[model samples]
Target: MTKRIRRLTAALLAAALLAGCGGSDSGSNTASYDAVAEESLALASGGTESALLPDTATGESAQKIIYRADLYMESTDFDAAQDTLLDAVDAAGAWLEYSYQSGSAKEQDRRVEYTVRVPVENYSAFLEQAGQAGSVLNLSENAEDVTSEYIDVDARITSLEAQRDRLNELAAQAETTADLLEIENQLSNVQYQLESYTQQMRALEGKITYSTVDISLEEVAVLTPTGVTFGARLADAFGGGWRMFVDFVQGLVLTLVYLWPLLVIAAVVVGVVLVQRRKHPRPPKPPKPGKKAPAPPAQYGLPDAPAANAPPQSGKPDAPKNPDAPQDAPAAPAETPEPPKPKY
Candidate 1:
């Protein structure tokens, strides 16, 4: 009984080993845990080797990203900028892909553009250098991660290769020519699929290793009025000023022509004022200094003049009887003094 139990254990171990050998090739890229768990389950159930999907890869392989950039820029000198771009491309181990130019050198809006494929490691460096060649108007960059597609393609190729091996084995065992032909046809179809997958993977790898760049260049020159020189501008300023002065005089004359009736009314008013001033001229003011005026004649009906032969009164002059009377009105008479009061 002890020997029989030992033999049973050895047989079971041999079966598990055989299953591992069969699954190992298909599961080589799979995670270790999945492979181990699958093997254990197959061992317990006494099943044949199980083909596995790529284990849910918790850890990713190296990233595969296709990078692209677009740059738009203006240059002071298009020729020089183009030359600098080429040199920068070579320096960064990149290659020019395409270029185009529109318009003649004599045209103001002439444009030039370039495209390049730069090494992945040098992508940023090359981009910075390209921008330095001119004034960068716009820069855009994109990254497309091809890692999932890349892995899937790789996995598909692995599956196809395994299938091709089985087809080849079956072809080798064919007995008749018709059977061999059928197997060859199937093998050919499988080969074609594998080749297609391989080509796709190769393209993805190429793009991952090298990034693409598109640069558009334009030539710009400072713009001014038709005549650009300082001397021309100064001459224009002086001419404009003279023209403005002439326009001002013309406008003034035109305004007066349009308002002629109003102007005439104003002129007549001024003329009337001057005529009235002349017609009603005022008297001259008396002299201010040094003259004595004559006394008014007496109002008591006294003789304005003494008799020419009459003797003159001596001592003080006689006082007028009506001193406060208006010079032009006569006053009441007063009697003369009686002879001189009889002298006694």
Candidate 2:
């Protein structure tokens, strides 16, 4: 009986060892299968399987992508600066959407909007390049990883595609046109869902791949003024004002000076006219040649005075004047007396 008990104990030990070996083999096989599956799922080149399709996937996980950047630059040459900015964009493989100038001569501003395709690995490098375009005044950068949302959207797309394929197969099996129409309507609905998901995916992809860059450019002004200063400027302003005032006064004086000749001519003409008016304006007629002027009559029956320059006319004319009978003059004198005597 002791021998029998020992045999049974040995048999039990062997069975237990066999069971343990089987358990070990089963666990090893399961581990190997999981590893193979993980490797296969991680199909992307040079990437881990988990990176492509994460352990946890959902519809809302991979739908959001966030990226933004803003920078400022200064350059002396606007065109060259703009060219440099364009080159930077090209280097970054960005889309130039908008650019423009702002402000006046002294203060000018230039701004450019570029939608840059920032490779997930090269976002930092892209920003560095953009900053090298000019002197950076202000810079801002932001990023958000949407690995969860992306996984979610991908899973939803897979499910939707499977549903659509199934609907297509149902349409193909339809025996009647009405059945086909119903299947088609269901297919259409699936397709619409697929389209909506596709659009959302594309938008999410755009947000992930392309980061927005808002760049502002300012022209560097060399503070070198052409020797203009406070005192000099003030002097210039005062001098300018004084010159203007002088010019105005000179113009007035010149205007008055212009009338000087006219005033002089008028005064001369008036003086000459007045003098002529006061003098014999019309000349007197000349007297007749050799004609004597009438003499004044003797006053109160007095004998006429002798002319001062006359010759001594002789006594003869006075005696003939009436030494004879008529006292009035020699009258008919003697002849009259003789006639009277004859009558007696």
Candidate 3:
């Protein structure tokens, strides 16, 4: 009886070992537990097991999703087109984190730059609607594949998990605390490595799930009054110059008009002052009678009066020696007297 009980115990131990071997070898202990639970549930439900089963995955994977696009559209009114494009993005439940626009009416062109994010499932549908925002001029898109990297991370995670599990089993069979501590330390390192792999896989999956798109718009040139001909522009410039000249002439004339009255008043005052000065002319004093003028000297060409000191001329009876001259001849008187005496 003792030999039979020992045989039963050995056989049960072998069966448990085989079941654990069939579980996943992935670095994730959670995956291993899930497989074991699934098989146990299947057996309890009386489901027949298959002879051959596919090999289970025992690792994490990595992936990256990246792409770019270029789009073009046209519209008569720039503002309207811009509004419609914005509306489309909102309706698609997407967000544009960056955008820019610049252009001129002459060129009939406007450009926009956008960095956007949309739901992974809605990327294709949103792009189709965006195409109708205006006239489509050009379109191109591309995506990069990273399936190989995903499988690589999965394989690494599997190896780390198996190492960690083996260390746990060793620590359970340890004879002392020191031996158990050593095994635990190695297990910690393996678990940390496994966790690192998991984080990397999640990141890759996120990138592959999202897509990016870029778009541009072109404006149509239209006729407007602001776009005048060369001749019309020249005429406008000349008109401005003429207006300035006319204003300057009018200012000069106004100044002269204001000064005319002042000039007339000054002239009248000057004339009145000159007339008053002339009317009060000074009178001349009469000449006084001075000493009579001396008579003119005798003429040089005529005879002049004789001097007082001059002798008497011989033409007159000579007042001869006597002051008083006898009346007859004295000699004749003496001879007549002698003759009368003789006759008596």
Candidate 4:
């Protein structure tokens, strides 16, 4: 009976060992299979695939294109051309995002710049219509394909949204205050990213839906020649030179107009200076070289007459007079000689 019990126990031990080994192997296989299945499922659903991958089921996704155009044009009749351009815009169902008009009819440099937004469907038609409004000086177009970028942004948005939902669930099931707070923080971050990505997506959509066109319309006296011939070039050169001369004259006139106040002030100053000079005349200058100076005038006065009470003078010497007799005759005294008459 003891031997039988031992045999039974060994059998049971061997069976238990075999069962344990088999169970471990099965568990490993199941684990590997589950891993492979998860990977296959992820690939089938495109969950782990690159966002830039082209869609296979739909053949290919529609291209996301952002179109922009720049047009520089000139027109002789500015007002009429402007009217035409506006009509075209209205016809195309486009709106002017920005518009600026400068220079006036008097200036002869009337210019209008328009930043127009047109529906993508009307982009080509609008360009054709706008070109008709004026002579095209320059035209440029750009088409940007944003398919990959669009897909990337969209995928990121979807991921962030899913993460937000998961975080919300986690927050609700959180056991501890700290855990709940952490999940809420993650949730907030996910929400913020989602909002940012959504905004970006909307902006991109707007750009794709509505193409932008920048138009510059300038008033010109002559249309630019489209030909590359020498004659055309010569004509253009002549026209440009003439226009330059006219512009210079116009600029000078405008400058004078703007400085009229200063001109008036300067004129007043000059007039005042002239009047002051006239009021205060300068002294006469010296005689010129080789010219004689005027002589002084002679003075006129009466000549001195002979002294009064003088003896009579003769040509011959006086004879010796008797002292006594002479005294008696001298007493009568010589007649006073008359003074010489004054000359006029």
Candidate 5:
């Protein structure tokens, strides 16, 4: 009985080994077949093996370029130019991402700016059409190539997706709770990385597909010349000076208009002052110093009056003293004159 059990055990072990070998071989064959199918699909789509592989020197793809432009222009008629710009944008099937306007019509300094997004196919045509909106003062264009970056991001995304799929498969096949949890954690990390790279790829594609244009539009009475000749420069200088002067005058007028209330108040104050002055006129000024007044005119024919107590004139003969005049010689002693009293 012991010998029979030993033989049976050996047979069971050999069967188990054969089954394991067969399963491994089948899995490898399936993997090889999938790889071949993928390669065939890539070839059918005009892609090479190198293109399917990352970090290979033989693969080449279309260039991914981001285009940007800046345009500064001036228009004689702001309304017309704005219409033209809108029409151009509509014709090009472009949209305005941003728009802003500054200054006012009264100042003749109205300005409008636009940020536009246009398809790559319509970039040149849109630029040409936009130039007609006004006389271009400045134009600049730039292009950035993102082919390498695009390829790198795409490859990384593909790698992360593959890693996530492998981790999911491992999680499903995991026998222990600990192994399953670890695989799930790894899968989550791979998923997060995939999402981030996918977003970057989409952003790159958007920039590559659409071109950006920054347009500045200014309202002006006259178009600036593009010439660099001495005469043109001189004319531009004079024109600029004239425009400045006109702007200053306009600003001054606007300032006055804004302060009309204050001006009215000042006028009312002045009127009140004048009315008060008229009601109470100032007194006349005093005579100036160092000027003497004229004396009163002399009488025409007035006789001279004799002085009181005057003696006989020296030139004329005197009358003899009479006896009555001798009575005054013995006049009593003259009394002292009394002091004058103070007057109220």
Candidate 6:
């Protein structure tokens, strides 16, 4: 009887050991390197082997793509063109995402920049229309294929959700506080990952649904396509000249601003020269001759002045008179005596 009892005990112990080995071999382990195996483990732990995920893997998950464009253009009338573009956007069922306007030279030029979001169906047509809003100086288009990345994210979210469910199950079964706390920490991490992935997916979907376009509008004093109305022409005729003059003045000021260094050098050189001049002064110049002395008082009465070209003298070789000969009336006494006798 004792031997039979021992044999029964040994058989029972062997059966129990075989059952434990079989269970360990058949059970799914989340720690497995294979992703599918890990997911199976999680499903087992969560007791939700048939749990369903959202319809991300269906038609809703088309080839994920991001579309964008950049447009630089000139407008005839800034305000009018902007209004026209806005109206067109409404017509096309697009929305203005944002806008900005600034000036490189407020007096000369300004720039208007904006971002618009349009349905993918209307994206190309909207670009064409917006391009016509003005003379397109620049047009650029871009495309990004994110299908692979999106798939990756979606799979990650699904896995994380499964993990969270399994962790929740573990938490419920946890006997000790430490075990519960560890499970909660893992749940938190999984939840965080799920949230981040969901946000990214939403953003990507938004981009796919509505293509983005960045536009830059420029306002310039000239080269606009606006018509020349009589009034506008007249105003422009005058205003153009005025603006040109203003530009000239502005350019002059800018030139001065830029050339200040040259001007300063010139000024210093001039100052140095002036200082040197003051230190060593120049001598005064001598006076100049005024006029020739008047001709010697008319020669003592000659009956008449000789002509410059008159023949020199009658051929008589007269004797030269002495320079000391008396010039006073000669022999006046002899003549007076004769005249007194004739009168008596």
* TM-score against native, each model: 0.49, 0.43, 0.38, 0.53, 0.53, 0.49
Query: In candidate 5, how many Å is residue 162 off?
Result: 0.9
- Can you write out model 2's per-residue Cα lDDT over 101-150, one digit (the tens) per residue? 65444443333444455554456677787777777767888877666555
lDDT of predicted model 6 = 0.65
* Model 5 C-alpha lDDT per residue in residues 178-290, reported as the tens digit of each score: 66665565556656667777888899998999899999999987777776679877987897698789889989999999999999999999999999999999997765888
RMSD (Å) per prediction: 26.4, 33.7, 35.3, 22.3, 21.7, 22.2
Error of 2 at 141 (Å): 1.2
Weakest 10 consecutive residues of candidate 5 by summed lDDT: 15-24
Once superposed on the true structure, which residue ranges of model 5 sit more than 4 Å away at CA? 1-58, 228-344
Residue range with the least summed lDDT across 10 consecutive positions in model 3: 4-13
- Expressed as tens digits, the lDDT of each residue in 1-344 for candidate 4 is 33332332233223222222321222234334334433433454345422312222212468899999999999999999999899989999999999999777986778899999999999999999999999998999999988766665665555455445545655666667766666665566657667877888899999999999999999977777785679877987896698779879999999999999999999999999999999999998989999998876656795655689888677798788776663433356568989999999
C-alpha lDDT (0 to 100) for residue 7 of candidate 1? 31
* Cα lDDT for residue 272, candidate 6: 100
Compare candidates 3 and 4 on lDDT and give the better one. Answer: 4
lDDT (Cα) of model 3: 0.59
Clashes of each: 0, 9, 4, 0, 0, 0
**Cα lDDT of model 3 by residue, 242-313, tens digit:** 756866898889998999899799999999989988997667654558856567787887877668998856
Candidate 4's TM-score reads: 0.53
- The lDDT values for all models are 0.68, 0.57, 0.59, 0.70, 0.70, 0.65
* Model 1 spans with C-alpha error above 4 angstroms: 1-59, 223-344
Give residue 77's error in model 1 in angstroms: 1.3
Q: Candidate 4 local accuracy as lDDT?
A: 0.70
Q: Find the number of clashing residue pairs for candidate 5.
A: 0
Better model by lDDT: candidate 5 vs candidate 6: 5
Q: Model 6 over residues 153-200: C-alpha lDDT tens digits?
A: 555556556556655765677667765665576567667767877787
